[model samples]
Target chain A: MFDQSNHLPALPGVGYKPQHYSDLLADPAPVGWLEIHAENYMGAGGRPIAQLKYLAERFPISVHGVGLSIGGECDLDPDHLARLEHLCDWLNPASFSEHLAWSTHESAFLNDLLPLPYTEATLNRVCAHIDQLQDVIGRRMLLENPSSYLAFDESTYEEPAFLAEVSKRTGCGLLLDVNNIFVSATNLNYDPRAYVDAFPLDKVGEIHLGGHDEDEDDHGAPLLIDSHGREVADPVWTLLDYTLARSGPLPTLIEWDTDVPEWPLLAAEARRAQTALAQLDSKVTA
Target chain B: MSQSAFNAALLNPTANRPNGLSDAGGRPAGKRFDVYRNNVTVSLREALETGFPATARLLGEQNFNTIATGYLRANPPSSPLMMLYGGGFPRYISAIPALAKLAYLRDVARLEYAMRQSYHAEDAPALDPARLASLPPEALNNARLTFAAATQLVLTPWPIHAIRAKALGESGENPPAHAQPTLVTRPEFDPILTPLPADQGDLCGALMAGKTLAEASTLHPAADLGQLLGTLLASQALTDIHVEERT
Candidate 1:
């Protein structure tokens, strides 16, 4: 097992891409740490795991899960939970996080981070899943809020309140994805700032900043899609600054999954995040 | 709404929206459900495209998308791991009536699947060539070799290697009308495909079936045994060898 004491620094990191493995190992720039999709590295043995072994030794790794489907309807899949346990046992990353969304139902695994109605029933289901996940992995995982294009009228609780109650119940931390908040707010016509203010900042252990695409909703309102395919948008950066001002410089990640640019471009995004963290530090010192 | 009913509607767009599903403003949730449906289908299609690039090229993007939708509806992913998402795709392609005319399409899909398997297969140290050379001449015939986990053999009736090469832009010319047995091995990090002769393929097949060198050589009498052994060694495909003594 890796040393769990070495936590990820409250600095900037990027989602690790296999294509950039050699480049990262060669230069390894000033990037603080690395994050990877947990499912991508769940294979038996291969380059992904091998590269992770090398990188895990040098940096504080973050295992961001995409397939846990924690908010799914049925009981959490035991097989999937076992896979997660095996991976966590081996890597023992500095932090582990998963989405507040569900992707599996009736044995059909949808590849998207889907939205769920924020009702008391959903809160109970999500809490149960998180409890099982934490028990299986033996770690306090962080749950990230989802970006949705629509809301359910059946939802009895607001998204922030639902997440806050979940954290309070499950004793798990939160991963405040600033871009998701912005996207959901724009799509739902809510104040992103208000959403952040209502967010349980004290429970936030990490922060995410990613790119989004602009599309019109059914009502012709501006809809922000959490695309994660390009550089972090300027507004998202400003939002990150806003989030960090309250969260006090949580470990930030610059995520670029699709249309992955060259190394320098991604590293520059992380540098921008680092700039935000540095600004916060400077403010504290001043 | 019941969880099962909601998931069914989410996965199948044509299904009627579940009861009690309304937007925050109390409007019908058709548009919101459509967005989620689009996300699910698009992401699954992209996963299929990534897994079967050659098949996608052969079928064309539009045609592949149609087939992918059918496959997705028929065989939803059993696991959350995207790397393991398209396990039934090759079989699905083979069973399609329209794809029957393209007999080799399924093989090409298999080749792509094999390459992915080799890419993620377990890693092991290659058996030193010196060990084989040092074996006594009398013991050489009884030596059973163990291959690296990343080594895979695909004996196909189609020129899958050539077709894959052409599809990947590695070759500009069309594939020849001859069957080719391909060997996939990841000696280092990246997996490589090598087309083998008929006799060599038979010999490898025999060896993989637990036949010793002498038995495997006999199975392909006309094969150049020295060349076969040399190629296997050079590719670092053999991981272990043991001599079986006969009384």
Candidate 2:
């Protein structure tokens, strides 16, 4: 019931951070939208709310949540949902999204986006949680793929297939994290391009670009860690370009959470995405 | 795996400490699990470094990281999105026996945490100076003043305001060697730290306890009640006011 073709802008965007507020507000970039971690603005009143409110007025906003724990066995958290609902009511963002992994279980929250076994039982539980979330927030949510460090033995389906199945079951969209695909594919020794091909492109509402770090397993197999602290690597850029060419234009975000550089550095990253999308679109027309 | 077992595997990895997992070739996967657990612990400890940089700096990074890891192992995050996490770290720091020598560390952590809490608290307009000043001298103290949602008072024995600034690379000698109560509030989208006069803190505390402004002023009659109200109003700390019926 919640289908909106214009939910996201065609231009590139960056995750909003207050340190860059002055830069973003003083000289509004050509960036399309500003995405914020939903929980950051859950407080009743404060600088986060004020600056976010100011930004939302100038650019489209997206509420990307990190703690919903959709894959957990427990029922959806009501208080967290209420806080999300309040944020949605105030921000009126363009699109909303959360991860496909669980970060909280029982009562302890590990504070890391951990992997979940891809199985029918888990799928059903996640879909039900999404339904509850949609009902509470009164809007559809886009579930993003997670960057996994380890694959569980109990998993039954591939990542893209699982995401497509979840979208079909829950009537929700997908926030395809291309960086996650790169990281997971490298860590698990799968082809990133093939994973993208298998993804439900039409259901994709957004895309994420970030950096990954290299590590090795006990046997010395390469492990790609989704650190999101550095610049986007050459191969990930190639993957993003390929995906954009196939899927057409979608709202993309450059997320650099750690070692956050100066505003101009991030703005340059967003500009790179803009150029990539533009080149892909031109190639498609040619 | 049952739902509970799967959850145990993911969330409570430290519960049974190390549940052995055997692969197809009979190799133990517990070592990999241990690595993942340690990474989780370190990641959270680093988050505290960002959340409470001043506290971490005051205790030095090496000592802070070691103590933070222990605190995290005992009290892991209650939420995945760390923006709202770390509320208990300040109190947890106080309970650690080894760091007890730095008696001021806990209060510094509390002051820093309160700064963050105030930074994300809420935005509310302060009462206009014109309206506040128009109140009768007698009614001024009797009027109940509401604080902005972002205002926070951290009554600490340490000069936290100075210590926090120094940690931020600001140039300043620590405040006179005396315990100072600090006021933290995001009056205009930026957190501000100010040292409060001893009597003024008691008055602010009285107001925080829902005391009528008149009652608060009565605690410190020498506090230039008008100017105090004016300064708080200008700081966006005074949000609302109502005359409390004398009881």
Candidate 3:
């Protein structure tokens, strides 16, 4: 099932920030790649574009989108799809992706990636949305797994099976965010490892490892919130190790959105992921 | 469902309470809708906090959160995602009847919002300083210079620049002596809010208004004309230059 056989690179990469542009450019560290939110650079001209240009010249770029509302019942957002096309034209990122959730209904942008039931109606809508995105952008996208809080009674399909179906239908790749698996598994009361094992590994083009927060559900049961804020937790690291062992080293990203740590701290986290991959490599070769 | 009715249902789910479109499954639909609404409101509020941490700090987190929620409900996002959430926030605050007593609030909001705008503003190369140096004094005066896309000269009746600086941690700096002109430029990736002297401010306004250098200088003779032009050029604030032949 694996066509791409080369081992992925093992250099550290942090979320590219405009505030640290000068610092990043000044010190030419051996950073591998930089990831940016596609929605932030949707506008025609701006500092976001400027800084991204400067960094893209030297580093591999990834355009991670937080919009597009792929799972929504409504048609694809033409305006967003156009902006995404423009971004792809301007910045030829190594990869482009969005979450497997809905964010908008009608015209009002809800601003959160809300979950959708895995039914035939949703599957058709999501496939149509993905087709529209590909038709506009002229490139395949990686759909990331979402961290969902609530489960719908109408969802007949299991999470992994639904994700596999989306990939099979749309020809889009998967962005496996292990932290989301842990969070959603805990919230929905499922086995995280089962999810990691069931994932269509051949379809996974990238990996996301982030930190989650501990919270209490309505029943006062412990839940994990995929906050993307603090350092990656030990359980998440273990899941990542499991994924690497299965996927055999992918382009893993460390995402820290809220309360972004200092550059060095983020750099260190990226290094930790690199170390995990290296450890896996040694075991596989031995 | 009809387009308008579907839109109404999505935007205001309560509109369909009579037909049971509100609740999904057995649970109250309002609870689910409330969760979605709360997420939208909180996300936009977080964008505001991220964009204008100083404003959030100055207004206090609770107050900012309260204002942000109201703004979200009043003007739900038109875009599928954020990145332009608070475009109307400044104007909203200016007319929010309750905030009328705080006159400077609008200016602060405007200043911070503009900074965010400029921060995300497009990247452009600054004008070459040597080009300015090569132009003859007469040609330099008559040359029509265009500022960079990220430079915005905002003239307000409030000491907005000083207020922003203080909010951003320049606590000991002296406040502006009076209402002044503020220049928001992104020399680098982040927007830098700098207070412009009266003469230089006039020159910037003239340049922004598509006036020739000579015309701008005529409006403010005391302006250091050389350094003022250089300040913009060095920072890439000036992008293109054209000198018209005398008619």
Candidate 4:
């Protein structure tokens, strides 16, 4: 087996933003760690890289990559892997993760995290990709479950089962995104709680929660778009509570990527996540 | 269906859904598949609309969206780095029949892209202007200077700096119907632009191309090389200075 774990404290973290850099430095509480998209810092040199260097010294950084196309059928992009290696070499972040989704086809990279079918073929493909990523990064990398808008007929395993098999095969940790779980459950007609019950909680190294938008399919069924443009929905928070109670506590994160609000508001969300972990802590102690 | 087919459909909204896709009911994923399609276009369009703000402003938001959709479908990103997604957009739109009349618009887009490149360029310290002053005249004449990675020279036949300034809501003198030369430099982190007097660009361009000071000075006699060198040094654009044997 491999080291499929991370060192992030089991506390709430917020995604880093340039606007909030000063605030984070001024009041460094509640936010126990920070996560950044690996591609944004792939540039040779800039303020983005310089700031990450500074922040890494102060807080634990989890390099969450969004563009690796880990589930694509093609071989992993060697140049992209080298860039990821270069970033990890210098930053040496506390944790790193990527979504179990494909974003590229041939030469064109679709900028969205497109869903993948969990068949034996894809299972093998994803495991190989993670093995390559972990080997290059020289550490265990967590794989996040993507929020899907539709299911595939070819899929041989349910989402949780597929995630488990990948973790088992690749020795990669799971970044259980409760919001994605909730969204996928509602869209795919499954009980979110049942889905969580089936999840392998022991392998979870971190958790993610983000805002989503509600829409409808052509059939008028509820469809949720994982638009991290606003506050997390109430039901997702409840689902997070359910998850934390079972998994104990983990390095939970609040991801607000679009139309970001003020620092205080985002920090408040982190405080709420902290309360969730704290509640679980009290139960264990009592 | 193949990932290529799915991606093709994602980029083209009118394309039919790939096989094997379905909603929870196991039926045809008509609108469900549309979600992925919508995400692909909307995200790429937003990246362009935000990236070339001046170009977006020249063409109003509504028009920009329409052009962005066209450009994205035609020149979908080859790489996953969205920061580098629009590298070819300036040329892509310059050939558009609708935008053919805005000849300077192409240069404006080029300037915007240069600014972005300079923003992410490697950081290097600037050589002090006094270093050039301390060099003896012969040594100075033979000196070949290196520029900061953030330095860029955009030479155009239109008042690009003025056009960009006005488009960005900055009050500036009405752009003349003549050529303009611009210098781009990032002293700290943010990239800024300086308008150079016409023809002085040749001197700076030559020096930037690694020409010796005497050789660059010979390229443009009317232009004040001393003043231009002082400005480049003041902008902290020069990184290294090597005085080679006089040639």
Candidate 5:
């Protein structure tokens, strides 16, 4: 009874942190929907679940999983998959997505979105995991691009190519994290626009913009950490315009996870995103 | 490199950033690797602090950081549900020698953990007190109380309730040295810690162990069954009551 299209409105949304619960409801203004970290709401009940239920009625929630470890060598945890099924069965969110990075090694959950080495073997494992996830959740899922600080010697495929092939194989969609594009591009010495140009824009279901921390890697090159703690960076915003120009407008989320600011600040960010989406809507119609 | 090797090095900041990792250039990636190390430890440390705020306050911020760092390394979360992380932390603090000076610290951690657990515990509709009131005294004596999923009883020798209250700046009195059993009850969304006297704690414990009201009341002569029941009712701790019929 729960199978339905996994689509979020092509507009601005924000990652729902508990701190913003009251303000998000009070005056969300231009936020088209909300996205929740699946791990945070996995609890059986309480304020988290209560708030989700109430908000789900009013907004299209996108369940974003941060700990699925889709790229892990170990087989996907059946219990974790079951939790996802339960959440989907209940929330039946407008969209569901997890990262291309793995966060677990065996039973230990590292709780960080660790990078993956792009290879045929890794592709096979990720596709298998996505297949299992879709099968169990009974919904198409979106695989998100990771923000990388370093490259793996073992990787054979470019990041965009690997993502496209995974989507093609698993029939899953892609979530283009725009900030990650800029972060990875800067850290790895590539053009963010070119990465967007090579991306399979047709497959992108969601777009994400979040804050990154600036640091220097071993050789004094810029290293951008996907901190998600501050306002969306300016260059990352430019990349979003580039992506939206190509993707033509998608459900763009302003993700502020750590040190989440007051709601008005986040709402302002959402308003900016809304303007971008509104402009695209007019262009597509024009 | 193997994920196991990566995992081993990720948790141990002291471990050599190790060879075989790299930046975009072929240069060895020691600093690039520390980004992951910093992310893992720092993020998990913050999570631990959130899960045990009272404990964090009881042990000063620096001491809590030291213990949390040690506890996190010894017991990284087994599941992705960070809300459920630090289940073993109370026991972890008990074994630390440096914290041994703080006799109440372990139980305080346990109390804080229980509060967090109860905060996220399943919501259940409280049993209407009128039902119990309507029952005849004899039948009520035979009745078995079913506690709400969000209710927890943590028995500790330290006055954890007073300590938490003082930590929260709700009171100024240094908690008198006495055994306190904290009853964690979520009347709404926030879990409330109520210190129960020994007799009342035993009475609640008995009810939790499937003892009937009469049987539970018998365990503690000093327990004010009426007042205790009133407190539970006010907290919405009881979800249902099944009074046995003579058969």
Candidate 6:
């Protein structure tokens, strides 16, 4: 495994937005770091890559990939893997991460993260893909747990157990999205705390916190959509506090991709996560 | 079900649920699967809308949604990059029989595609205007200018730039009756589209085909070469100028 000694700082960050590029360059503020979708910067060259070059000089950037489809049934796309390798080679980000969900199958790229059955077959497939990814990027990648509206009957293993097994086999780190735990637990009608307790916190290298919209499943159960369109909800914040209390501190990100708010608002959200991290530090030093 | 089969089911709403697919509670996952399906279609549709905003506006919300759905079902994204999505959209728009009345729609979509392409094109420093002016009079004939990667000349049979401006609320006047050839260039960050006269368009087309200034001028002898050069310089479209090597 590639050495991760210089991973992201255990502070609060936000997904980088183009509109806030000038503001960030002018005043980076107290923000700990910035994250970006890898695919967005995959173009040949332009303002997006140029802005990233500028920010990479100032902040520890995390390249969060949304398209790897690590959990796909088919072998990983060599072309996509090459592009990712090229990007990682150029950016040399502090951290690289992709979701545990699949977005591509049969060469058709589905835009959203889709869930998979957590079976032994899948565990093996995902581990192979993660191995390939780590080998190509020449660095360790954090596999983020996905928030889902449904679960499959073929899933022989629980989500947390499956993730633990994958980490054990691949030596990959985890990106524990507290909001995803809350959203998935709520949608699947389980206790969020239990899910968090069952997670392998020591294997976690980063954390994600995003806003979700509330709706109802067909059975009238509360369904939380992982829609990063607004501020982090109070429960998700509380969940973050819960997970941090166990994991100490991790590089947490405030992801607001859709209906993106002003830079100040997003910075404020990052500040809120920082407040929680500060509380953890206070408790630890106490 | 197999992973590919499951994905196929998710993409095609009309397809039957994959065998043995059930929710966490061991119940039928029909309603639950619908959520994933909705997420996929809705997100792709939103991406198409973002890529072709003017086309969406011209067709209106409901009509555009219908068209986007049909297009998506027919031509799902082959790449994960949203920027690379909707490449087949212009042709798809042109092939629609219902949109036959809007003859300029496809060209407008093509213009939008060009703007997107230019926005993401490779960055290069604009050549100084003096480089061209200081060229020895004899060398001027063989001087072949290299345009920036973001420079694109879009020739259309309709007033697409005007129509786009009106749709985007950038202009108050209605689109004119004449066909308009437009030049797209990204001097800084944002891509700008400028209307070009037919003669200038012909000259630009010729120049883009690797024709030297003298040879390109032959295509439009009456065109104001100075004005055309001025426009290109003003837009920072010319990246490098060099004398063509004698074979």
Highest DockQ among the candidates is held by which one?
Answer: 4
For every model in order, what is the number of clashing pairs?
0, 8, 8, 0, 0, 0
Off-target runs (Cα >4 Å) in candidate 3 are A1-14, A18-32, A43-47, B1-38, B80-83, B125-143, B171-177, B188-207, B211-236, B243-247
lDDT of each: 0.87, 0.78, 0.75, 0.89, 0.89, 0.88
Report the lDDT tens digits of candidate 4 across residue range A1-286: 1121349889999988889999999996899889999989988687988898888878888999999999998889999999999988888888999999999888888888988888999999999999999999899999998998888888889989999999999999999999999999999999999999999999999999999999999878899989998888999999999999988889999999999999999999999899999999899999
DockQ each = 0.67, 0.44, 0.34, 0.85, 0.80, 0.69
Would you give me the overall lDDT of model 3? 0.75
Q: Which residue ranges in model 6 land beyond 4 Å of their true spot? A: A1-5, A25-30
Q: Report the C-alpha lDDT of model 3 over B132-211, residue by residue, as the tens digit.
A: 78888888778898777778777777777877778778776867678767888887766777777777878788888988
Q: Give the residue spans of candidate 2 off by over 4 A.
A: A1-5, A25-30, B1-39, B167-171, B213-231, B245-247
Candidate 4 lDDT for residue B30:
85
Clashing pairs in 2: A45-B121, A45-B122, A45-B123, A46-B122, A46-B123, B141-B213, B141-B214, B142-B214
DockQ-derived CAPRI band for the predicted complex in model 6: medium
Ranking by TM-score: 4, 5, 6, 1, 2, 3
Order the candidate numbers by DockQ, best to worst. 4, 5, 6, 1, 2, 3
For residues A1-286, write the lDDT of model 6, one tens digit per residue: 1222378999998899998887777776668788999999988788898888877877888999999899988889898999999988878889999999898878789888988889989999999999999999999999999997777766889999999999999999999999999898887878999999999999999999999998876676677889999999999999999999999999999999999988889888988999999999999999
Q: Which run of 10 residues does model 1 chain B get worst, by summed lDDT?
A: B21-30
**Against the true structure, candidate 6 has what lDDT?**
0.88
TM-score for each prediction?
0.95, 0.89, 0.82, 0.97, 0.97, 0.95
Question: What lDDT tens digits, residue by residue, belong to model 2 across residues A144-165?
Answer: 9988656666678888899999
What is the per-residue lDDT of model 2 for residues B61-157, given as tens digits with 9 covering 90 to 100? 7888888877777777776557666889888888888877877878888887887777777667777878876878777667887887778888877
Interface RMSD, one decimal, each candidate: 1.7, 3.4, 4.7, 0.9, 1.0, 1.5
What fnat does each of the candidate structures reach?
0.73, 0.46, 0.46, 0.88, 0.80, 0.77
Decoy 1 TM-score against native: 0.95
Task: Give the DockQ-based CAPRI class for model 1.
Answer: medium
